[model samples]
Target chain A: MDNFEQFFTENRLKLDVEPLPEGFNNQMIANFRAVRRKKQTIRLFAAAGFLLLLVPGIMLLQPFFKPEPVALQESPSSAELSILTRLQPYQTEIESSTQFISQQRVPTEYSVQFQDFLIQLQIIDRQQDIYQKQIDSYGYTEDMIQQIMYNYELKLMVLQKLQTEILKINKLSKTTNHEYTNIQLEI
Target chain B: MLGNRQDAEDVLQDAMIQAYTNLKSLKSVESFGPWMKRIVINQCLHFIRGRLNFADLQLVNTPGESDETDYYQFSMEELNSTIQQLPDGCRIVFNLYLLENYSHKEVAEMLGISESTSKSQYQRARQLLQHQLKKKMNHG
Candidate 1:
């Protein structure tokens, strides 16, 4: 124990360290102050982001301010139904279609086919209006008459042609469900 | 050997500034001293990198002026030079264990090394420093 104490004493005595010059503490204080300033900046940015998240709710009803869920509730209609609330997907498709049509420098045969498909769809819509009017006028008694007058065979043929043209247009757009899947796979 | 006190002060100040700026990214605040020391050491090493050779170490032979001289005690200059002479890993372990008084387990956690490795490095540093002191005494 004495030997150990002597060794410790010698070690302590031999330990050499110079005092930092005067104002060293001041430098450290300055550094700590700078650190505080940086922390404040980060806090400010985080506060800004947090406030920005509240912007959408500023005009909303007070009920929306309820606390977030603590535990997960099992439900089948969790997220997918959100697509139906806003016409987001359809609006996006319309915007993309308009952009594609407007941005093309050269008009191609595909554009003509697309225009024809639209015209054909308009015609079918008109025919459906006429059929609806006839059905209403005849009441329940003229079912056979209404069916014969509309010519179901010709109408079916036109409907099948419309379906085929719509499929062609979907293919030309390069934006079908299959293409969406492929793009998702690539991503 | 870094010219003068002003230059050392400048380097040390810059190193402190860098450590302060990057303090948030430092996961462990308990080991802040060694972390700051590391930055300062690196700056000092960089300042004297290419200029150092075996002959430069010979200047460390400044003899004790008296038997009871404080020069035998831990002079910052001598301590700094002794630390500078240590290998990178050994120097870090030495400072952590000696000045900071960190246990091998704590040093291991701080350095992301095994506890045994920290213990072994600490032992190696002690042995190496003893060897260096013996050599200095014999030469002097």
Candidate 2:
């Protein structure tokens, strides 16, 4: 753009170069190392963060990792004997009700409801088994016996409610009232 | 704008530290030279603006001759000696537009000056450098 720029261009290499301060290069090397160390520290922290997060993640997935079920005693021991005897009738009733509900060719809507109740009943059965193991391990209290009896009764109640609802729905819906009326669920 | 060798050295060191810290953000190794030059320019601008208000510089009429990107490029040592001879506003505009190949608009934004102010200050810088160089050529 100007003769002055031509002079600058011609003398570019000849132009005095600014000398870096004494020890400046070495100081920069030291800083680079420090920065590298800091980056590594940040990476380590991130890894530690991920591992800590996995602790809760694994805990949340704990139900899927249930331990192998322990086999029940061949014969009931004296400690659990009294409670098991009291629970037998309700247990038989629950088994028969479950089979009857499953065999029923109910419409899909009531079938979905029955399946939900059945899953709940299975969860109660598992709970009762847990209390029985506790009785075996630490001996039974009246509380343990009462809880097992309560679980069985709850299952029967669920089955009865389902049966009553289906019967009521069959009566109200004109499609085929006599078809559902012919079937009776054993409590 | 940062007068004196001690201050210049300090800026250089600080600029090196800044570039080193953000090296990971640099996209290419080959561009390190220009990228570093840009950083140093920014640091110098920051150093100058900290003490001097850029808005205070007076603008003039008529724009200066615009130089090409590679035309006025020079070494930092040459710039250090050359630009310091200029006043605050002209020194920064000259350094950015001439030595570093920045456009007048870029210089304006960097210095918080109007584009017209950048151009005029550059014109003044061009006039001053021409006078100074001619004096040196004839006298020295």
Whole-model Cα lDDT per candidate?
Answer: 0.53, 0.68
lDDT of 1 by residue, B16-68 (tens): 77777776765664565567766776666555455544232221222212122
Best by lDDT: 2
| Chain A (alone) TM-scores for all candidate structures | 0.25, 0.44
**What tens digits encode model 1's per-residue C-alpha lDDT throughout A33-130?**
67799889999999999888777567474455533332224642543244233334443554454444434332243444445545654575577577
Query: Could you say which candidate leads in TM-score?
Result: 2
DockQ scores of all models, one per candidate: 0.06, 0.09
Give the residue spans of candidate 2 off by over 4 A.
Answer: A9-16, A19-34, A41-187, B53-56, B61-83, B137-140
**What TM-score, computed on C-alpha atoms, does each candidate reach?**
0.33, 0.47
Pairs in steric clash, model 1: A15-B74, A16-B74, A16-B75
Consecutive 10-residue window with the lowest summed lDDT within model 2 chain B? B66-75
B96: Cα error in model 2, Å: 1.3
Judged by DockQ cut-offs, is candidate 2 incorrect, acceptable, medium or high? incorrect
lDDT of 2 by residue, B72-128 (tens): 444446445665777777876776776666898998888887888888888888777
B123: Cα error in model 1, Å? 0.8
